[model samples]
Target: MTRNNYAPYITISREEWAKRSDDPMLHLLNDFETLQGLNEPLTMEEITQIYVPLSRLLNLYVSGAQRLHAATNSFLGSQFLKVPFIIGIAGSVAVGKSTTARVLQRLLSAWPNHPKVDLVTTDGFLYPNKVLEQKGIMNRKGFPESYDIRRLIQFLANVKSAKERVSAPVYSHLEYDILPNELKWIESPDIVIVEGVNVLQVRPRQQQKEPTIFVSDFFDFSIFVDAEMEDLQQWYIDRFKSLRQTAFRNPESYFHRYAHLSDKESEVIATNIWNEINRPNLELNILPTRFRASLILEKGGHHFVQSLKLRRI
Candidate 1:
């Protein structure tokens, strides 16, 4: 795989970016009460200091995209396309991309201009367990090949092409499988957040001929949530231990077998899984795509975003 140069980005410290108040929208973090103390327990200061600015930035992008779409329509003399500004968020397992996405969803929706913001995770795009088993890639679940890329592309295409409604499969974390009977429907949204481990990935040149389309091709903006490999492993193990007593206790859960595991046993198992599956996937597929992001959020020891690098316009 070819590496991308980071020369396009300008690094900004948490303290510095937090002080930016050129936009009036940056002061609206006080209304975002629902996002406080999520599963990761984001601090109030973090919300004000980090994500407020990010929400404003995304709003600007969404507004610009809306204007461009309208201009194109005027030039073509037709109300043709209704493209939702698509935002892609990528990261390794347990790197808090979901938290960033959920926060952004809440914050962005608060803006009156883009009240209809929807978030779709790529986990829902993963092939069903039965299908993965048939393909002999069940062990490779969460890797890029485990996903139904063509279907995902079609779903995005439908959403971007002003389809009245489009549906995507839903994945159950407790069941560790795609719910065969369930689907999440997306209607007309002003902005869409596509969050996943593989959203930014590109097939290696050696793997096949360069495709005419990629999942990232649909994105107007993208973010990569980054942390050290060791930190990610620790976070994964911690979450596993927490889930052992909660989600794993459900008899219907595929991970129910881990319900009885002691903290030590859970730690050992999670660490092993990290080393075997998640680590390799991060190194080979996920991490390599980091520079492809429009912005990179670099997190510290406790999952706090310490700084960010934004691609210069």
Candidate 2:
């Protein structure tokens, strides 16, 4: 197919734009100053200029999903019960994927038709660091093997199947591990947002026997937060420093020792950590998954998404 033929078919009519202009969800996009963890929040003008279109775009996708369900129900017989629509958000570390997930969750939840929306991050699916250490894979924490793929797959399966109650392990940032016996529970919702660095990563089917059930397999829609490599490097460094000062200062924090470093020392540590750990994980495990997302949000150094590219259905 030619490039044009392969492009995403985004249907944004004037009527839709008019409706979105007055959408209440567009209001939530205003109160937040900047993407979360940024030094400052975005201005109202910036929010309007950037996210108004994005909110409308997401609304269109959600509406389309409902129509698709109706069509499927017609084929399967009218006795069908609707299941939650799951959206996956994936990107490299510090590219603002968390912020994107939160924005979409807030906006999607505001929809009167789908107010029961919920969000779950895949960080909770990672194997505890102790487990990774036992496997001698502590240095590969964010790599695909570091995650409990089976547990993650089962969790998504349950969510997609409309199970009465679903639970996910909780990962502790301060402790830098998955908290034992801590879980987040969810009831059926109109929509669910699953966010992570490798949510869109693809793996080969096992022995070509059964369909692969990688995390992306359960998504009805997916988003990738994208930015220039240099910009992401800087953003990672900035967030790392902020965390070192704040979260790392906690006596029980896994990274507490780094909190007392001098500014110059901290910068060096941040740069090394980014280059050796975060950058490689992004390149080897996360960046390759961008093409698999339903939409790609490209950001500028200012942290505002400058452009959005949606995949062809």
Candidate 3:
């Protein structure tokens, strides 16, 4: 495929990017299996070839941000607290973003200068089932309107301002809802990763006049995991099948009923969900923000990152 010459990003083959890094940090490979998401393949070779260099690049950005912070403090002649460097990871569901975020958290934290890297997913910010039902948007669960946007912005603002303690609502995949009175507390971290499908999305202008902020406003760097539409649809269906055998089998799981369906029946339901819900969200909401990312990880058919795109500064 020919490069889009007018694009703001510099596209490079994975091999070309891998040439810049020689240190694989192989000791970290042991954690890969645990961190990887279902149906996501993350071999040590892939980590060394792709993520090693990516980690180095992130470290550079973190260092530069810290330097700029210190310089700004000096210029103002005021002692300002150091805020965490925030990275936003965005992509469609079942595109391996969770694995990417977890891998980055592990790799970035390995750096001695930034030992306290914390990861949080935007799933926590999604509105509860009751709230969605009240709004009559239960079918649009992953859509932008299904989120508590104002609260998400406030949470990021607190993180960017270096708040002593910031808390986020906890979401449970098994329960498929927000857990009441459960919160994830984040202390002062050197870096914070906010991962979700809609992290790169810009709010619709019709929603509010003169909106003050967006979820991405606080991101120092952002990444979009990209793949062909067909690949994503297939992955989503495959993931559903896998979950039916695993999490969906749990008596308390919200999707427990799905486990009882025949293989063909499950496939039909999964395909319908993908075509009606997830596919439209990807086309209308998520993919539009792909170019807005600082970097894009373009995946091939086997879910391997085939290329990298870094937005020109």
Taking all chains together, each candidate's TM-score versus the true structure is 0.91, 0.89, 0.96
Better of 1 and 2 by lDDT: 1
Q: Which of 1 and 2 is ahead in TM-score?
A: 1
lDDT of 2: 0.79
Best by lDDT: 3
Poorly placed runs, candidate 2 (over 4 Å): 1-23, 29-35, 38-40, 74-76, 205-210
lDDT of 3 by residue, 1-313 (tens): 8986676889899989988664746686686789889999888878888888899899999999889989999999999999999999999999999999998998998876789998999888999999999999999999999999889999999998999899999999999999989999999999999999999888565757685678888999999999999999999999999999999999999999999888899899999999999999999999999999999999998999999999999
- Per-residue lDDT tens digits for candidate 2, residues 1-313, read 6565555535333234334454454656655645455542455554455456565666777788888889998888885667888989998888877777776677677666678888899999999988999999998888888999889999999988889799999999889899998999989788889999998888664587876768888898888888899988888778778887789899999999999988788889989988888899988889898888887877777876666666775
lDDT of each: 0.87, 0.79, 0.92
lDDT of 1 by residue, 1-313 (tens): 9997758999999999888533455455555555542236576677777887898888888888888888999999998857788999999999888888988997798886789989999999999999999999998999989999999999988987888789999999878889999999998888889999999987843657565578999899999999998898888888888888788899988999999998889889999999989999999999999999999999998889899999999
Against the true structure, whose TM-score is highest? 3
Query: How many clashes show up in model 2?
Result: 5
Q: What is the lDDT of residue 30 in candidate 1?
A: 59
In candidate 1, position 50 carries an lDDT of 85
Candidates 1 and 3, the one with greater lDDT: 3
For every candidate in turn, the CA RMSD to the true structure comes to 3.6, 3.5, 2.7
